[model samples]
Target: MHEWADFSVEEAGGRTTVVVTGPLLVSTIAYLDDDLRDLEGPVQFVDISAASPIDTVGAWVIYRFAAEHNAEVLGASEQAEVLLEAVEESASTADVAPRRGWFWQRVPAEVGAMVFELGRSMRRNLGFMGAIIAALLMLFRHPGRFRVRALVRQMELVGVTSLPIIGLMSFLVGIVIAQQGAIQLREFGAEIYTINLTGRISLRELGILMTAIMVAGRSGSAFAAQIGTMQLTEEIDAMRTIGVAPVEALVIPRVLAAMLMMPLLGFYAAVTAIIGGAVISQVQLGIPFLTFLSRIQEVVPVTDLWVGLVKAPVFGLIIALSGCYQGMQVRGNAEEVGLRTTRAVVQAIFMVIVLDAFFAVFFTEIGWG
Candidate 1:
């Protein structure tokens, strides 16, 4: 019948004692906060033995009042004492400030953390590479171990299915190059040189580079997503449990397929690009298809074609390995699969561009440029 969470004060010997009574629950505690804050003079003690069903919020309020007055909490029941102790512990922890170093001082720590992460990544990737190589060796020793059916299936998926899109993209790129080159060269009455420009650039660099980038975005991401999903479903673990090497059963087929098909795809892309350049030359520059072909034959060396073709397998290997590595790194659920897939594409594309730059420099130095 009485009000909950009401307090009474008694003054004695120049000190004050606050006695808290009634239910100290959320519903009643808010009304007591103002009363607690309004209490004046040095408080001797807070007696809460009469309080019923004290909760964390009520305990925290009483703790704060006692702390402000440097007053002891007396007459608390065992349960209320436990709640007060917990609140005190939490408050102590919350009051502690986190230590921080200056930005410049933390640079070394940040660099070290980055280096550690990079090293871990490299080690994991190298382990995956070693597994694939070991599997290959095993397959060579026992030819029956090869997954011929899987290999053929992946080839169709990674190569044949990709042709239309790759061809269309390369063709459009070639047309743009030819049209832009003609616009620039026409100023000097050298529009015919567009054929030479398109042929040389497409065969030597753009053809394979664009093809690899597209494959990295398409098949590479697919590889990561597929393997990542298998991992999420524990299928990879099941394969391991059954003594089936996942590298051989899953990774090798995809890697071998990509490597075998990349060169063919690059050649196809180059030819399509050349045809597109010829068409654009005829239509936009009035150079005639025969004249464009004749110029390409005379100006573009066979070594340029070989250069692009040779880079294809290496690019394919990088993309496949990057994808599979990221896939294997995936843990947890569907969101992790998506993140690893995105990382695979970005990493594969980055490596492709970096290798292309290195190839450019090496070729130039060796007179292959």
Candidate 2:
């Protein structure tokens, strides 16, 4: 009968009745909540027979007052009764802070959890690799299914466009290596050997290793973010619904691009780095740049170049796989995309470094050291 709720208490024949009236809604509850709380009495019953269109907030207010006064509710309509009961049922205790244990116990638990998750992650990554391999095989069998345009686009993104930055980085790194090596070797009157150090290190390790890291940070993160956005937008699902395989369309091209482009990029990086070292050689070491460049062939063996070339494609494969795998793992929300993108870059770099170490050991054992 009224837009706002109001209550009045009546006493008759040793019984108290708190009569509630009007539309008890969220927008109107505030008008009478303070007044209701101020009343102190042995309230026996809360009569809402005149209350029209009660909302959850109104039901909650009435329920709390009745409970506090040890009074019973009366004349609540079916919907209002259901709302009151639902609010009552929803109440519960929850921890205000995270649970904790003693330091020693907590450390072990955390370590165990980390190890378990790492193992689980490795298994999942292996499964994803297997799936990619199967998809590649299927594409090979049905050559018509392979996406050439996508592959070319990824190659441009992963390799061609990256040349300027990678070249600059390699150039600076080479300069640093030559400059630092000259500083240290000057002590033994072996300054000329800076060429050997610069050539060998750039070709055998830093060139490809740093390139892989760059690709992981750049292309890998981009892959995760792009694919993750597609996933969130349900474009991946749409692809599946329309009989287009996501892996063949999205992942394969990227993988192939990285695999094909890394070798070229690695070689390019090494060449640029040597030019950088040669500049330092001419400027600081008083050796002619062209002479220093020519000396690299004689001082740095063919095996060093082979080492970089061999490792390049494998590193690229790991980086691409990490990116695509983490991207595909995205679900639920936008936050997941960010988390997966970071994971992709971190996972790619970590795997690349680990693989580089393994390759080092393997090559040394095989007489390529």
Candidate 3:
């Protein structure tokens, strides 16, 4: 007989006991209630003395019945326990298989989501660009509402406030560069030309690179944190509801200001770095300040200085765009704001370095480097 084809229940003293006398497979469904309701008993006494032959499916049915009734299966036959253990192990393996597959699928889903977000970001920026053009046209027509105060204040904050730190860092960097060059040049009796090499390299590369990195860390982080805070507080939504454009109020101002200020900052870095190399030349190479300055002036052209300055707006755009994009992606939660702020700074720095490389290669190809 099938282990599950026939079953008997014994009720005594407010308890139920079940025994299997036939095949215990799909046939168990015949007796199962439609709803599988009230299938639980306080204690299930299995009459293992019968030595019923049950398969894996039969054991699964028995386990399910026992669980539904919140009952403990007593008198489990040795064969029944062995069958049930295998069934349980199979179920566990099944569970883990799906989880492993899900982990792999999750990675592709994350990539797809990022691509979707990028498309949405592009649309948002395009809309902002339209509004910017419209505003410029209006400014040309009316020639008013162009507040120079805010512009000046922004320039001062982004440019002047950042100057001292940029100056000091560039100075130290220049000294190190000069010292390194002196060592290598001295070996070839080309020590005097070290000033020219250091000056030209710093003006064309180090000054701009250092300044961009600093701004990415400072201004980009501030933009992200500020916009993220506004997002968490729903200030951005309020502006939209009140007929104010978030881009005009937040993005445009910051982008314009940072772009305007970066060139000035790059200039400051270049000048300070030149001064620094001069100091190093005096101390390390025993060259007078006048001679170092003259050599630097001869090798480093006005165009080299201009090259660093020209790259500033592109770097500033990278910083502002990365920060703004990350900030806009922030969800309305404190943890999300903090996370996006960190992402903004990191992405800005990475993009700046990447753009700097592009600039370096382009300049070299054009005979500027």
lDDT of 1 at 319: 93
Please tell me which predicted candidate would have the highest lDDT against the true structure. Answer: 2
lDDT of 2 by residue, 111-190 (tens): 99999999998898788888888998998899999999999999999999999999999999999999999999999999
**Error in Å for residue 64 of model 2:** 5.6
Per-residue C-alpha lDDT of model 1 across residues 85-145, encoded as one tens digit per residue: 9999888644367678899979999999999999998898788889988999999999998
> How far does residue 317 in candidate 2 sit from its true spot (Å)?
0.6
User: Model 3: which ten-residue window has the lowest total lDDT?
Assistant: 32-41
TM-score for candidate 3, please give it.
0.69
What's the TM-score of each model vs. the native? 0.76, 0.81, 0.69
Q: Each model's C-alpha lDDT?
A: 0.92, 0.94, 0.77
Weakest ten-residue segment in model 2 by summed lDDT: 90-99
What global local distance difference test value does model 2 have?
A: 0.94
RMSD of model 2, in Å?
Answer: 4.2
Q: Cα RMSDs of all predictions?
A: 5.1, 4.2, 12.1
lDDT of the structure predicted as candidate 1: 0.92
